[model samples]
Target: MALSLVHFPSEVWNHIFQYLSAADKFSVRASCRYFRKLIDHWSLWKNWTIVLSFKNGPYNSEFWDSLRRRKVSSVVMRNTKTKDWSRLSLALPTLTTVIMDQNSNGNLNFIQDFSHLNRLAIRSSAVLLDLHTQTQLQHLTHLSMCNVLFPNKSNWSFLNLLPFLSSLTSVVCHNTNSFGQRDRMVDTLVSILPKLKHLSLSAKYISPQRDGSIFKPVTSLSSLELIDCLDHSSPEDVGQMISGLKCLRVFFKHSHQGRPEALSASVIYLKTWLSESAQLSNLTVVKGPPVRMYATSIPATITNLTLCVSGLSPRDMAAVAQQVPDLLHLHIDAWPSHLGAHTARIPELFPKLRSLKLRQDHVPEKDFLRLQQLQDLECLEILDRGHWSDLYKKLQTLTRNRLRVVTSSPQRDAFHCPCVSQVY
Candidate 1:
């Protein structure tokens, strides 16, 4: 007698269904009812995200019922113009994540309908948030807004409502045009959102209040990122804002329009803070040119350091090595004329370095080969692939196949291994 798929128990069929892609699973379901039942199991749909379009009309009852039956927990709304959110809320009460993008005619009042929503992202949309309804989203833990507009309110007034959602742990606001009174807005958020742990903001400029007072510290915040948002502020002001945060473990500051003098001043303040911070383990500074001046201020507690600047020289590298002897990860994105001359000394400089990423340094193959001397090195990434051939195999042979080499664009080869492990 021949054994057939039906002869296997449903448990085995369900296990097999997990390995199949959604399209393949649907194809298998079409073949027999047994497979169809197994394919419809909620476990298979647990990780699926449904994309819905409201440009035409609301989905029919059968479509909504199917989503509910499958236990769909996430949905992405595109081209949304619907006002019939009550029906959606009643149909898919299990939704925990909602993303609204490219929507122009929708109001955020619908967010109150999803009682279980934990994450919400709004992008490229102009919408109104009903302040009364926002307080009802008690379960929302993460909120992200990008290029969003709330025409009825004053600049960044939506931020004032964040205190009502007590469960929020993370918030990101980027690329919005209404950034007036940033100092007051940020001050209010940090003071009110006691549970907030992560915050990222992008703006044209970030400075202290008109009264010359710096940002207040928040004990709960562990990670902070400011993007393209520094200018004219005194180093003392920047230092005060960062040093006040007692729990900050990770900090990233990137700016494209910042003045050279202001950026250098900011780095000087960062050096003072870095020397005193016992909890700050990861740091990134971009578009600054005076890293060498403050390299000695880096404390040994920092295990991860990233510098994206134009003034990183061989002497600066040596200074960083001397300061942070236990540094485990280092990334330098610079094109200094003499960096390649000092490449051979890296192993001697950072003996315990586990990962190294270099961009546009143009080190020679022989100098690159000297990196094999790092006994603990696990990964080496090079952005400029001009000077080496068969370098990956050579390094693997030297390290007994323990090291992973990634060349060219990091994005294209990110999966080769862990791509620059996060500080957290």
Candidate 2:
């Protein structure tokens, strides 16, 4: 018998409704008064992430405003327009994550509302009139701040930004090379953000000052990263800093402002510290140079390692194959370091490895023989730069080995971006 939609229980109907997008969910609610009541009873629409457009198109802030009339609490705007942020309806004080960033341009503005906000993300140069950067944000846990500029006000210092975010646990902040004076900005950050477990901060020339008063270390820090550390500190000082973290996750990468050689030295000392530091089991190093310089440097107890090198070249693969024995998982963004130089020579080295993930740049070619050698391959994704032409061949290869399922997505403009998604 064909069942009518009316006979389904609210719980069952909700399960079906959860799959719909916020816009589609609203459309369903608008079909009738009963839907409005039912949707209003659901919290799915209470938090929203909408991209604001300053250019004033069909899907701009006004569009979001219309949706706001339905009662959305949180909003995450990506690649937003200046006007969209300048023209918010202020009905969204309930928002927890707010991202107004992109190639758009507009004068930054301050928010005087948000009495119920817990977390916030801003991607403009606007100075936050931070009641504390976070206070009264009782439920706030993660904050992503990017492209934020200093207003030259005596009142708005970095340390001043943190007392308000008393509840923040994770943060990802990026500063443009053209940003405020490097040392001053970094000094402001290190002195602030008192309590943190996961933090990703990039800076230029952050040499630990002689006067401990100038740079007070945050003792509660657990996972610390100095990504793109541009001429920040001497190799010795950096090793000292890493040693201070009782438990940590550190990532140091190459940058335009500093010498690659200096970054390499820091990586070596970091590798040393990881080996000696007690109670530190998680260690990851990438992007500086050959792993041979530091692979054996990793603590033998380390259980997780990710390498972001260009390709699975011999030295790179060999370093991993010989060094890490207690490793639990491996993720590699595989690309051709040299078309026929290194990787082609070493196909049979990684025999003891457990889990492997081969992420392609744009092509859909599998290093088939490499897959056959791994003892275990848990997750595989065929990421297509545009579209897959040889889906069947790849699928047949996967089915032949009885490997676990894989996930994929074709090349598209608005795909999942870890940087933009999390960098508030």
Model 1 spans with C-alpha error above 4 angstroms: 1-76, 83-95, 153-156, 177-182, 203-205, 212-217, 233-235, 244-264, 272-278, 335-342, 381-390, 406-424
Candidate 1 on 218-271: residue-level lDDT in tens? 456676665553434323343344543333322234432335656555665556
Model 2: residue 307 alpha-carbon error in angstroms:
1.2
Q: Model-by-model lDDT, in order?
A: 0.66, 0.50
- The per-residue C-alpha lDDT of model 1 at residue 32 equals 71
Candidate 2: Cα lDDT at 238: 42
Winner by TM-score: 1
lDDT by residue (1-424, candidate 2, tens digit) is 2347666687776677776766677798788765665665435554445554545543546545555665665555555554445455354555545555553333333233555554556565445343443343445676655666655543455555565665677666766332344354333444455555666565343444554542333445566555554334433344444444543444444521235556456655556656655445555444555555566676655555566544445665676666556666655543434323332222355444455454433322454434544546454443323244355346447557545534443222121224432111
Clash count (model 1, backbone only)? 0
Cα RMSD (Å) between model 2 and the true structure?
Answer: 6.4
Clashes of 2: 10
